[model samples]
Target: MTAAGYITDVDYIPGFYPQLAPVAMRHVAALNGVVPPRIADGFRYLELGCGLGRSLTTLAAANPQGTFVGVDVNPEHTAATQRDITAGGLANTRVITSDFASLPADLGEFEFITLHGVWSWVAPEVREQILAAAQRHLAPGGLLLVSYNSMPGWAHLQPIRGIIRQYAVLRQGDSAQRVREALAYLLFIRERHAKYFEDNPRAAAYVDGIVKQDVRYIAHEYLNEHWTSFYFAEVAGMFSRAGLSFVGSLPVHTNFWDLCVRPEFQELFRTTTDRLITEAHKDFCANTAFRWDLYARAPRAMKSFEERVREADDIEFRVTRAGVTLPHQTNLDVVTSTVQGPLYQALLDMMSTGSRPLSAIVADPRVAGTPPADVSRAVDAGVALGLFEISARHVDTATGEPRGPYAMPNDFNRAVIASDALSGRAVAVASQLTGTGHTLGDLDAGILNELVERGEDGLAPRVGARLTAAGRSLERDGKPIKDQTEQGVIMAQACEAFCRTSLRQFLQLGIVSPG
Candidate 1:
């Protein structure tokens, strides 16, 4: 391997994107709402470390109107991405191989930027260069998406990292080869020190699981020359240094102070007058895989009201009580009350059914006969009412489109369900209650019921659905949600999460028309 030991080869990972644009666009579009100013004209997107251009490809395909540029230092990834762009016949996207400091002058400014998997793996200098480039290229009101390894969440990996680094240094050249050798040696050490596993089953299980992981992820993640994890405060500070401001998370549900962890914990951390504690808790929850930050060129600080509004805008849709439907109208007094057509009237007719998704309700005879065009029109009208939400159908980069409208990747699902506190219990109950892997509605009911029983009022079905989807995505992305990879366990957990969030979101917005 070269001294720097970057993974320079393409892994032929055609379907490796963490999230797909369909779902993302739904959320982001809903976040943008009707505000044309917050949504940039001639919006340009820039991606740092565009591996094989998978993400950019998805983004370009989904947002045909937008332009995207991706840059990476790895020639293999760049070449493969270029090939994909050509084959896909994408005119809106371009990819180049260059260091952050050597960006092409004609690239122009971007209204949205994403650097996933590059920030924490590079030297501090490169990180700064990337931030500098982001600040320079980003348009005012533009969004920056940065994902990285994070502290406290990744604290357990530090010891493993130290061991890998130590072993890697002993081997000459061939970083992948060195990683393999080191892993073997570590296994030998673990076997000899079986007593360690005896006392700490969880840690031992983690080690065993790591041993079985794809060697590429193992080699690059653990043996890399520069792998740094950050705290929320540090990340915030870095972006601030680069003249960017903290907006929220890409998974909009994640950034909300109301969604993460236990309510007590969140209340303590998020509302704390103490900034450090709040940041520490954020680091603990996110493990720093995804970040959604917003920046403007003029540097006038966003007002608290403006930030809150923007945060709400950036979110796909919030799950809220049925009574609170059309909040932007009743509370904020934003959307017009004028009805558009019979389809719109039909949608409102279904809302009395207590938060059933428009997709589900449309299958019923009352709406099934509606033309696709009319259905879409009705859906958009509800979007105007703040009654019906438009969530993107989940897409997989591995496959052109999901065979179905949704994917319930169970293995990944279980890991996420297992990781949470209340969600875990809700998942367990929902699985038992449904006698199968949980669906969006099942877990949504389970969690809201639990929360209500625990005296938390104002429970909404859409809230649970939104959270569930976020949890499931994390699982399917190979982030390991459950402790064990037992049959169906992971899948159940992930679906449970997806169900909760999706249902919550549908319910929160009037997206669900009642039968």
Candidate 2:
């Protein structure tokens, strides 16, 4: 509850999210007349409100051939992002600290521009500037990703925001304390005014999850000065004004679910286009707050098959040079078992073409039924297994080196190995943090050692053993170091919290030490 307890990036949870970008890119690629600038490598990506650039780093790591630029007004955030970029040796990623309004006149063009966690939190003028920037900088047929708090789901939070805003403004110097107070007040009101949530487990569950988030996130998300939520119609109009059209979302499942859940919903909304259906659905759902939108500049052409193939070929070259593969697993049988399923068979079918970008495969007519998100997940799995490799063309060579935009992985020959490597490392890292008293450094060491012992690939572990060794050294010292706890219980809790909280994706991979 203390102001000193606050962390910078932790508070502003609004920032670039890379996981959804691949799906957005795929949708843009499929649009009419908007082929990516370079069919083979050297694609550009721009992120607005990049925060500390965590997502940008991940994207840079995943797609080595691509170039990334993150723009933000927060000097502290940009500095931190630069630190990470330099430390990770991700030469392909760059950060710029500047207000959106003053973005360079010729910021060049980007195939993918992301405004994740930005639109709803900025002032109207700032939002307009961002749109203008995107309009000017996005390539023909480029992708624009925007996420916001949509209606229906946002209704319940509206009251909470109203209450918190007044309180947070009064306690500007201590946002965390203000958040706790606001939460306590909400809990008190819920005791008497509870209605829809009490009857709906899903709603209750969602609220509970939010409450459990880091207090700083609660403060920034709920109590910000310019915080606002919008309807799909409103956001769609904004995108149109920016010269972008709504495509689809990575959470593509939910968009389709509306039809299945209501049966007639799709038929009734069939006449309407994507934005209208999305708006109607939001109204039906009572204004769901969180969503990711896939938008692309209109008046552009879809990427050609030859161009897609060329991009895939470049991605393959980068991956091979990096020598990244999946993790090695003790229970190879279990993983092998999973691979025999329809999903695995489908993946194998794609990999049979040797190394190819997952995006390209998903776009192919044979895989037309497959969703872009699914392809991303599959590719991520492949990367973990050491079956695939990732490298930035510029990272290996100088900035002038020619490289394509797409990221490719190894074919079936390395698929299992890559999968095992990636899964094992992810699980090992997750396990060490979730249940063991190990640091990220420890997890990194363990995974890297495993990878090396199994077979030395060129993928060097970025995280060093220093953090883990330092933790032990600090424990030996015992005296207070910053705000870290001295008590054994506190230390364990802190380590676990740090691990579980920051590395949430590891949990999704079924990694995590014994609970």
Candidate 3:
């Protein structure tokens, strides 16, 4: 570790990121008509800079068939991860404490390698080592997912980062304290109407948002000694040296041209036949701040239109929100649009029942006349809008059996819910269906924890007691219930909603069983 001890600091918070899940990565690849590596059976998955290893541990628990390895420089992070793995009784995951530059040569190849929030935060030499690892260990057709702050979008915020870092270095305090001081300084300057803030008005909003973010996150993001933002073409060129070709973005929306770029720029984008140039132009148009890019060692041949539609048809989707109303609005930070049409409404209606495969949905009489490609596009749009979640077909390929409500309780979810209860801090819950973690709020975690301890027969009273202990009471029509009878009624209603919506979602995620 260096004298500053910054590189090996363990001050970072543990959190789960669903974007790094194999299901999510594979889904994005499939959206581009590329078959991702087989993760259903034995597959190697590695995450570099896996801080606290929360994401990898959750993935390992959800995906017992795959081997998961997380490497980080901080011994504290790796040790904490090992503790989590042991607690969870996970046999398929391990964490190693080693810097990227010194990664063991015999670590072997991986079907999927991810570097989340690390690419733009490390030194050039470290980045070179990461690429070398990818070059040596990324299996052919394997996906390399990397997320970083990108240029054009981050251009305005660069100066703020610089100012914060400079101020932090001169301040006499620990990382968190320095971060607070730095943010206060920035706010002081902004309030005083500094010339920098005057010229970059949007940057002020960025700083305001940053101030409200987790202090630890702000410290890691701004207090880092080395941070660089790149354009899509620039990062693409760097990966090209490692024989990796850009596949697609993890966010499915970016794959669709209409969703990413404006109408006027579409013609200009069409004129440019180069993929890199088109992406660069799109970045400028959308002001892309962060990117979750997927790269493959070798590009898969594009599937024919019929083949693509056939493959797409097998993927499953479920509505994420309840009681969704149309003129459905989708917000891509850069742009927001209302999706209003009979096709969208019909698709939403279909998903309201439960998880449905795209094939069955397209076969519905309401959309029977719609072409498969058009249906695929509509589904893609819906997913991008957060109206639906797409699960890769391979997630259920091994069973090859019709999936109904969960029949067997998921031990992983049970352990996770129990751990959350003991820790009194709820972050996320493991989702077996999607092979990822779903965000869990405190109340949901409390309710689920109570459900785990007391079965449905004893659920309501215990849950209500738990809520009452937490100073949360059942609400009816947005008003808190004080009367005992009304409280009972409202609690019953809340429990029903939990069973219908939250528990149903857990079932879909294979977190719990109908039994």
Each candidate's clash count = 43, 51, 0
Output candidate 1 Cα RMSD.
15.4
Residues 1-515 of candidate 2: C-alpha lDDT, one tens digit per residue: 11121234343542334334443345334322234334234578899878867667656644556788998777777887787677556778889888887777668998888877778877777778878898899887777778888776777657667766676566645678878877776666555557754664464555567677778678767765677888777888887888787765544333343322344445555566555675556456434567677777753443554544444323331132222223322122112212234553455455543445545557766556766656555554444333433321221211122222211121210222222232212311211111111123333333333332332232222112223333432233535444333443443444345343432323222222112
Show where candidate 2 strays beyond 4 Å. Answer: 1-16, 20-24, 27-39, 191-206, 254-261, 269-275, 282-287, 299-515
* Candidate 3 lDDT over residue span 1-515, tens digit each: 32123444426777888889887887787777786776655789999999988899888877788999999888888898888888788888989888887777789999999999898888887888889999999999899999999988899889999999999889986888888899899999999999999998999877878987878888888777878899999899999999998888957788777888878778966677687987888898998999999998885754664665454444578776768889978877666778888998898888775667766777788888888778877887788778888664323211222233334265556666666642434567676566778877655776667765656675667777777776767666767778977777766776667766676666656666555
Best by TM-score: 3
How much lDDT does each candidate structure score?
0.52, 0.52, 0.78
Against the true structure, what is each candidate's TM-score? 0.57, 0.61, 0.86
Q: Please give the distance, in angstroms, between residue 217's alpha carbon in candidate 1 and its true position after superposition.
A: 2.1
RMSD of 3: 4.6
The candidate scoring highest on lDDT is 3
| Pick by lDDT: 1 or 3, better one | 3
* TM-score, model 1 to reference: 0.57
